[model samples]
Target: MKLINWWPPMLGTGISLKKVSKDMTTFEVIMKLRWYNRNLVGIHYGGSLYSMCDPWYMFILMANLGKGYVVMDKAAAIRYKKPGRGTLKCVFHISKSEIKEIRSEIDMIGKKDYTFTCEVMDEEGEVVTEVDKVVYVRKKDFDFEALEKEKEAGNTKIPG
Candidate 1:
């Protein structure tokens, strides 16, 4: 995907894509918690805070894993450490070599799942949120004939 299209979502929300690596393993995005992103208590809006991290890791996964594999968010968890003031930054990093390894495994075993974790840090480098993402990946083409056989035996339910 082009960086131009990637900028709007972030800029629209007052966030910025500060950096993205050539290997697609690491990215840095920044956000300024303005009035629109403030809660009743004047703290940063939770949704906006969460938005700072959206799609970055998944994008990285998609870019590195190549085609014929499915990469999804799967799940996420965030820890609000200290309240954000001024601006906040989320630095996302993945291991390109590790992704290569995962791809190798998927090619070898046909199907495999992997998890990658990244941290969002404030300017002081204090982690504001720690996110763990699980992604399921497998070869796109599988034994459809086996599935058909199972269906013929009434052991499977085919979706209409």
Candidate 2:
């Protein structure tokens, strides 16, 4: 997690991972308005705002769904409500019931798209941007028994 928080892309954009729940159901990200990330008018850059929201939903869903499933970011949209002048933050959360619903949907349809929304808020708690993300999820095409055996044998790498 520390490694990811310091990943070059994130670091370059002045984004930091503040917290991640033990169950991976919740995540918080902070974006400091630094000179490097500021736009021509000295406010937060649009690209930085989008980058701040890029990975959280996919990451949370993947962790909650386990290695048996495949999760990918399918689409995204960001609506800039106002310019962010100072530090801004966003939180992403997936309830247990929602996780269960996603699983059930995938089970029924073999694949499903889940949409999640989050808001980037300024220091005053006013929304500066609204982001909508869609993720594609489905069970992997592989032998579950074989995958379990490999996992037990410590021969496979399960991504979080």
Candidate 3:
């Protein structure tokens, strides 16, 4: 979590990864309004608001989905409900049962789009921005353990 807080994009935009739950199911991020990140009107910039939400849903899914599945961000839409001036924060969480539900769906259909909504709120606890994110999840077609075993035994071939 500390390393992620220092990530270049987050640092550049004054975003911070504030916390991660012990179960890896929940994450908190904050963007404090600053001179460098504000728009001409002196409120939070749309890009900054979008940036705060850009990558968290994918991460939440990845942490819960495990190694046998592939997860990628598909699409996003942000609706700004009101002007934001103070610190803005968002919480990203996916229940373990929800993860299992996603896995079942992928297993049954091979691949599918899953959508989650994240809301950015201000100090007064009113929503300032709403972000809808779509994630693409698919189960790996081959056994990863078997492929690893083949590579360890020097029997796997690679195309040059």
lDDT of 3 by residue, 56-90 (tens): 87887888878888889999999999998899999
Colliding pairs, model 2: none
Tens digits of per-residue lDDT, candidate 2, 1-160, equal 6578778989999999999899889999999989899999999999999999998899988888888889999999999999998999999999989998888766544577788999999999999999999999988864567767878898866532
lDDT of 3 at 63: 81
Worst 10 residues of 2 by lDDT: 104-113
Deviation in Å, model 1, residue 112 alpha carbon: 3.8
How displaced is residue 92 in candidate 2, in Å? 0.4
Please tell me which predicted candidate would have the highest lDDT against the true structure.
2
Candidate 1 lDDT over 1-160, as tens digits, reads 4464356666566777878888888888887777777789876777677778778877887888778877777666676777776678877777867778777776555565566666666778887766666667776775657766777898864432
Worst 10 residues of 3 by lDDT: 142-151
Measured with C-alpha atoms, the lDDT of residue 17 in candidate 3 is 93
Regions more than 4 Å wrong, model 3: 142-160
- The lDDT for every candidate, in the order shown, is 0.72, 0.89, 0.87
